[model samples]
Target chain A: MPRPAKKPRKSYHHGDLRNALLTAAREVLEERGPSFLGLREISRRVGVSAPSAYHHFPSRDAIALGLAEQGAAELATCLAAAPANPSGSLLTYGEAYIAFVRANPALYRLMFGEGFPAVSQHSAAIRALRERSYDIMKAGLEQRLPASELPIAGLFLWALVHGLGLLLVDRQIVRDGDLEDIIRRVLTLAGTGLLHGRGRDDGQSGPPPPPPGTRSA
Target chain B: MPRPAKKPRKSYHHGDLRNALLTAAREVLEERGPSFLGLREISRRVGVSAPSAYHHFPSRDAIALGLAEQGAAELATCLAAAPANPSGSLLTYGEAYIAFVRANPALYRLMFGEGFPAVSQHSAAIRALRERSYDIMKAGLEQRLPASELPIAGLFLWALVHGLGLLLVDRQIVRDGDLEDIIRRVLTLAGTGLLHGRGRDDGQSGPPPPPPGTRSA
Candidate 1:
């Protein structure tokens, strides 16, 4: 693909410089991961001078924090927009959450403080946005679970989606089948519990009998 | 704490050189992260020449792969060592798995190809060790679940522990409470399912009745 001609510096209004720098930083983040999110490179990509980029971002970490904030806000929006069926809302939220991470792998990592260690520590806005996302999950659970169970229940759902999303984005798990189907199945397990024969002898009475076709009559 | 004096170069026999380099590399991985796992720095820490380090590990990536293999083996051992109880073995495994990651956060990240993207792609040995660990979990599940459900069931357990560990290590979740208690509760929820009044109206009726002491009625 041809490199689009760099936008001339004059084309970026003063108010637009920060967004342009963030946009370029995101590209670098996805392409090279967080370690390569250098200010000079981002500025070069934006066709802006270093000092001009500095005026908006100050440092690479600041640019990363900017990206993180943007990611957090977008993620909150995704979670909020998930269909709110009382019984299946978590599945919808989990799907939306993973979908967002799948679409913006690097940005999701950045939001979680992957490369910039201080982003989480320094950004109250990010923390609030993160809390908002968590609240969405907790609110769904609150309808059914006791208040005392909320923390662990919320954490369970969070960890399930969080781990599943990372495993998918990181390609740590097998990808031979449909990714969305895999996600739904996994979340369903979380919702319904994985153990079979729930009330029958602690569900550990050994594997169920093999299907009729597989065994000699 | 004072820095330890560097060992003399002559002290390292050829056979010991590889181990010494790996030890220093592990330290670097923990103190910094994978991005800082440079061969030169590791050699300097080990008081060996860069060429000597190169002789053992052909490149920085080779060193990372070495670390990843080491981490994978250690994790598999940890998982294998988890006690096998038909009913509670997964909780034990999950505890052991999270314990390993908590103890060696950086190595765990490297094992998952955090900084060394090619480590997972290039190291068949690492992949095998990883598979060995997963097999341990699947073995536990196989006793109860049918063969057809193994894939999703196994992935669900993996994602739960994987996500819980990363959240703990990343400090993405609140840390005021006992982490072990939190992990136990979350895994127990996985074991028992989170919904209240299961098998009754889909468990989504509403919040349970207020505790006896809390209600004024």
Candidate 2:
């Protein structure tokens, strides 16, 4: 998926160098993965001087944050397009989420990976984008569950989808045969486990005691 | 909590130098966080020369792999000890998982964080440790779930707890009052959702179309 560098043109017209830089940086990130991203390299691709690039992005982290902001927005769009029926919406949302991650593995990694700060620590704009994405899921959940359940339920749903997405990206599991079918079955297992407490009747078996001579670290 | 470095002893004793270096490395990782781990510093703490240190861990990635392996073993131990009653075992395992993360945030991060290779790419030992940890959860899930449902069911459970643990680590969610009680409630939501499809009946409201003028990347 190599993207050829755009031909450099005269600087006679300075049209949104900031956006041009972001687009170029994102292309580099997706093509080379997060580790290869360099502000100078990205600037060079966009035919901008280092000083001009610095004016918009002060550091590598700033550029990462910009990419993450874009990623979150894209994620929100994907989530928003999920089917709205309460019965199928969660599954649709889950499917859409996995699809997005599959399409943009590196960008998805940057959004949640150690390369960026945690959600709580992200810059204001990035944080808002993340929250907005979560809100789409929450609003979908709101139609079926009690208001009291929304917060933790939202967290659980987010974790389920996020974890599966990571596992897929790591190649821990493959989306075999039909992609949506796999998502549907996995989501059904999780969603049902949450709704009915399916294992409630199974007898309890306490974990075996630690082997003798074991010492806590 | 600070672990004072052992008094560097005479070079006359080379007893268990490998284990000694690993122990020191773990102490450093837990104390200063993963970012502070350096082979020379660890070897120095253990009264070893730089070349001696290199003998055990050729590079920092090797040391990280070692730490991750240790963390996986520790996590496996925690998972193995949960009360085994089929009815409550999943919840108990979930609680233990979160508690382990809360107790050793940095080590937990090291085990699951960006430092190590992907699961598919990990060396044999690291991958084995990871699978061993997951198998403990699967064993618990087995007692209650049909054999047909075990695989995906186990994944959902792992994702649920892992996601919650990460959210707690990131400070995206807080554990208020009794810790286990909160975990119990969150698990109930996800597990029950899977069992009953509680959100099944809500009307289908199609997700709104993407906002105008937005272009896909």
lDDT of 1 by residue, B1-217 (tens): 2234355644345447777788899999999976578888988987767888767777778888888888999999999989998778778888999999999987876776445656746478877898899999989878777777778778988999998988887788775888778788788778664222133224343332221221101
DockQ metric, candidate 1: 0.26
Question: What does candidate 2's lDDT look like per residue over A17-79, in tens digits?
Answer: 778888888899888776577778888888767677777777767878888888888999888
Interface RMSD of each: 10.1, 4.5
In angstroms, the error of model 2 at B1 is 25
Question: Which 10-residue window in model 2 chain A sums to the lowest lDDT?
Answer: A207-216
Candidate 1: residue B206 Cα off by (Å): 21
Q: For every candidate, how close is chain A to the native chain A in TM-score? A: 0.81, 0.81
User: Candidate 2, after superposition: displacement of residue B197 in Å?
Assistant: 7.2
Interface RMSD of 1: 10.1
* Candidate 1 residue B19 C-alpha distance from true site, Å: 1.9
